[model samples]
Target chain A: MKIKKVVELLNAKVVSGHDHLEAEVEFCFASDLMSDVLTVETENLLLLTGLANLQTIRTSEMSDISKIIFVRKKNATEEMIRLAAENEMILIECDYSMFKTSGILFSAGLKPVY
Target chain B: MMHFEFHVEGGNFLKAGAASSQLKKILKQLNVDPKTIKRVVVAMYEAEVNIVAHAYKGDIYIDIDTKKIEITLIDEGPGIPDIDLAMKQGFSTASSVVREMGFGAGMGLPNIKNNSDELTITSEVNKGTTVKFATYLNQ
Candidate 1:
């Protein structure tokens, strides 16, 4: 699915990488632990995480994940956003909890990284 | 072939992934495959994070070539008493602050092992730990 569709489906706010709204992502991994994020070995993946920190962006960059949607209203700080922008990663914020966000995205045909 | 070195200060979460980021950029410039680059970056990032989260300070030495990338991280800190226990997932000695950042899940070493082609870890209690990992570029 295109990231723009995800933003609309979740009523998410694009906090960074507005240019990447058209990017396509096939898989989603929801985890607060950066370690779990690293374990996922998929391409074109979107990370749905409740952890809003610099490490989140760093982990995504290392794992080749270009899109991240912060769940449960966990807003990415300015530093985090700056890093995402530097990495050309898209960051989205949603008010839904991680579980709900996962369910919504999964039902919409996004595969899990299991 | 290229060589890079970096010094990492423990507990400095802000600069934790700097080395990994730089390495990824270099790998991309060298035209490494995306999958191989991801594997190398993930393994190196996990090792780097271990140093920042557990050690007092550390040094990272990286050697990159067309065939493979090798990284060695040596840190001075309270080393692991049992390497086996530390390698187990969900076992962590990270502080509460580190846990709050969504780290210290005890998955760092395992993630490194899973991503790297070869991994070695040695430590002495109260002394330090040295982790050596390598990932093949063609795989």
Candidate 2:
């Protein structure tokens, strides 16, 4: 799924990335633990996370995940957003809970990489 | 196998993940397959977190080769009392502060085990912990 559709599906606000919203995402994984995301293969995936920490961006970078949709209305700090943007990751903030955001993205045709 | 070592700053959350992040970057530059890089990074990242979250003093050493990538993490923190108990997925002794950092959730070892082809952890009471992980290449 293209990132633009994902933003609209969840009524997300683009926190730092909009120019690259046209990026294509191939998979999704929702987890608050950076450990889960690190252990799992989430390449080209759109990560659904509520935890807004610099480590979140680092986790996504480790797995080559470029699209991070922060659910539960959580937003990344300015430094986190800048770091993600510097890495060319498309960061989004959504009001929907993690479960609902996952459902919406799934129904919109985004699946897990595994 | 040829060896490359990387250092991680202690108690710095902003710099906590640098070891694994650099490993991923170097692997990519070497043209290693994406999946292999993913596995290596996963294993390394978990170890890196462990170092920051626990040891309070340590370093990460990475050895990369054709068949596999080997990562060795050595930390001087008080060693684990029971390696078996520590291996459990939800087992953690992390302070509340570490938890707020979104780590210390007890998934570090299991996640490393899940991502690596093989994992070996050795620790001595009051000494430290040494974790060795291997991620085999398939492509």
Which candidate gets the maximum lDDT versus the true structure?
1
DockQ of each: 0.85, 0.70
iRMSD in angstroms, per model: 0.8, 1.4
Question: lDDT for model 2, on a 0 to 1 scale?
Answer: 0.83
TM-score on alpha carbons, each prediction: 0.96, 0.89
lDDT of 1 by residue, B25-127 (tens): 9998988888888889989898889898999999999998878899999999999999999999999998987887778889999989998889999999999
Sequence-dependent TM-score of model 2: 0.89
DockQ of 1: 0.85
lDDT of 1 by residue, A1-114 (tens): 899999999999999999999988898888998878888888888999999999999999998888999999999999999999898999999999998899999999999877
TM-score of chain A of each: 0.97, 0.94
DockQ of 2: 0.70
CA RMSD of each candidate after superposition:
1.2, 2.2
